[model samples]
Target: MKIHNPFRTALVATLGVGLGILMITSIQTLSTVILYIGTALFLSLGLDPVVTMLERRGLPRWAAVLITILAVLSIFAAVVLIVLPVLIEQISELVDQITPLVQNGEQTIESLKGWMTETFPNLAVDDVFAYVTDWMAKEDWQNNVAGWTETIGQGVLVIGGAVLAGLFGAFIVLVLTIYLTASTPSLKRSAYQLVPASKRERFIDIADQITDSVGHYVMGQVSLGVINGILSAIFLSIINAPFTAVLAVIAFFFSLIPLVGTLTGSTIIVLACLLPGVGSPATALAAAIYYLIYMQVEAYFLAPRIMSRAVSVPGAVVVIAALSGGALLGLLGALIAIPVAASILIIYRQVLIPRMDQR
Candidate 1:
């Protein structure tokens, strides 16, 4: 279509541009609000399955929700009261152990090289070790590392302000989560009312499946984290590994993130087991071997069983979805990616494929 009047066309174009700019500015301003709401909604969905299970056991919806919320609060309180002190103490000890290494880069590098050589005599690491040593010797790399370490150490002091802000934000999220969880059914009804009557039934079916998938996935992931934490705690305690509680806590939280979390946590745990005065090569080797086996079991056994029930996504698709999601929005994106992908797969299988076949 050609514009009949240039002045009117230009005016409309300018208005459109202004509107677009306004939208971008508004979104930027409300980014934190958006994050809080999204996180709360995600958590509410995760809590839904537990609420439903309680309701199935003959409790009213409100009662079920109350019980579930109370249980969650209890868990949170326990972590804060019982675990936080131990975690803090162990972390302080860990920092103390790391202080010497941070101050002396050459010694740290040499120690690391010696450990690697001792741990795996057959591994060809001499050339790589020489290169690293040479690099560290040149360009005052030691000071640079020390500077970075100092910056990180100083960051702990500034975290008080961020912690206060985070607490306020967390309270908001908790309140939102409670409301969302309690009103989920009504919310679904309200949403369904907006759909055309002809399509509403199908929409409800698909929507329910998607929500169920998300809820189940959350539960499964949490279960995996719990398992990892408990097992790590037991194994570490058995082997007399330093900071068993702290390491287990790390394992738990990190395992909450999808695919890469377990491996990342495992690496940290292994490294922690190799701390200069506190840890030995034997302990680090044992931790490494245990994690290697655990990863295999989780991938081939545990994950397949738990995740298969939620979404029958292909392994390749799962990896790609997680990577893409993580790239786009970090942790939250990665957590949401699988269920979102599952929802898409459901639509493809139940809706699009049928329509295509008809065509």
Candidate 2:
């Protein structure tokens, strides 16, 4: 005959609730730290293929890691050095050309008004202009700004803090990536040791395949981005497009997105081409045509060759993963989405389906 202690149970429940609350609070507070750690781990995985390639060529592990890091950093440095000055100069040139661009816009507007007046004698351009002007006056954005000064000030502070945090996060990720990359073998061994002896071999094999896929995905995406940027620069320069360097850089980053990246990037470039001082509708049309042809080439030829080593995710899976990830974590989510889908798919095919079949 045992008596249940009500007081003791209540106290235990209280303690458990308190502990859960503490854990939630602690996790919220350390969100940024977790973000950095995850970034570092992903970067290490992404860089592993390069490291392994060098290692296979008889380079020591340390030497392989160092070479891989150096090559990546060197290319980044070169891009910054070449693109920065050109970007700045292009920006300044845009600023300098703005007055002309505005004048050209006004002239076009005037010509359109004249044509409309000639075509429709009763059409009142003055009334239309007055209505637009009145609508603009009604908005009074200055009053909104005045009312939200404190909110705006807080926003500015938040932006500044975010920028500082970004820099710190980058540093943390770099250090962690270097350490993890160099120590991966030992880390894997230690991690595997935690698994049951019977399952360890299977776990290792699956993990190896998944990580290899991750590495291949990263390399393939990077190669495609470089190709996209270079091609954009060539085409934009040929058309004498304004802000070619900046547009190319934009294309480079946008090309990281799967499926629709090239189309999105091309749209942006075409719009820039349609700018008053930049390019005309004819040039924009030509640019669109060029990208259409390029997109087919990339899809049918370039992607297959570059991504041969990576596990293929279906188009629907790629799209859903990218959208879901982007909705959750923006760039990082989108960047990792495909690889995540690939990993899940690998598990499904190798583990889940086989087990189901066995059952």
Candidate 3:
């Protein structure tokens, strides 16, 4: 391995560095594509268990894959068809209510003043209200509204572009997921062929365990989200919360993220319960209390049962993994972090620990 010519060695080293930089640049440019592939692979792994269950029930692999895909698509379609209209209507209503307040500063301030006075009868708010009213009166409400209108127009354009891009990305991921799920066994065989024959069995074992763990974790997380969504809808309806359907949808999606999702969703739900016309302090308080209790029940009771089959990552490791992953790759990273951590722990325990012991 000794180099005879120093210049030749230097030239080779420089070329290697340049090639690495080129590769890095290429990867950075293709990061979005990579993200889509990773998401597809993750979802395919999650679908593996369902496909396996169908196979066990005497269905052919193709049939299993077809059924799984159909089931998922049906669920998604049902949600869009049943929930989207109601969600849009509620959002429109909210916008309508907010528009008048923004348009009429005087009315908004007067309403705020009245609320403050009624909520805190002992506090003298006359001077504060007068100052606020005078300051608001000095500003040009028409000009402000014009500015807001312009901003909203620009925002709508941006949102429309983003939505188009998102839809395209989703379609790509969906196709990739279906392909990956269908060809998973063949793909695994091809990959295993690349490994040294002597070590292939061990590799397969570890790979299967990791994939199984990932599938279980995804299923468990989805179960938790569904439970949260259903219960949230019922409870919010009982309390006459504004936009209950929207809030429940929010709860479901947020609950898919680990650790902080429930807390973040709960905070939003409570705030929504305090909105004007449809909410009161009592309603907010009630929502807050319910969430606090629900969090405890989820942590102690539901999560354990649902997630029993998934690898048990340590709490500290889960926290660190989630934060680091989120910092690195945003939401996708956070979603995959715990399972990745579990996989790493598996390797450490099975390989590293044994090697160290041999030493």
Q: Show the lowest summed lDDT stretch of 10 residues, model 2.
A: 111-120
> Please, what are the lDDT tens digits per residue for candidate 3 over residues 1-359?
88799999999999999999999999999999999999999999999999999999999999999999999999999989999999999999899988998899788878877887887788778987777668867896556988998999999999999999999999999999999999999999999999999999999999889999999999899999999999999999998889989999999988988889899999999998887666888899999999999999999999999999998999899889989989989988999898899899989989899989999
List, residue by residue over 1-359, the lDDT tens digit for candidate 2: 56499899889999999999999999999987887887777789889988988898999999999988888789889989999999999999888877665578678677657766765689998788778769867987557767688899999999999999888888888899999999988998998899999999999999999989998998899899999999999988898777999889988898888887778888998888876546676788888898899899999999999999999999999989999989977888888889989999999999999999999
lDDT of predicted model 3: 0.92
**How many clashing residue pairs are found in candidate 2?**
0
Candidate 3, residue 223: CA error in Å? 0.9
Query: Which runs of model 2 end up more than 4 angstroms from their true locations?
Result: 1-3, 99-134, 141-161
Using lDDT, rank the candidates from best to worst.
3, 1, 2
Q: What is the Cα-based TM-score of model 1? A: 0.87
TM-score of each: 0.87, 0.87, 0.91
Give all candidates' CA lDDT scores. Answer: 0.90, 0.87, 0.92
Local lDDT at 266 for model 2: 84
* Residue-pair clashes per candidate: 0, 0, 0
Question: What is candidate 2's TM-score against the reference?
Answer: 0.87
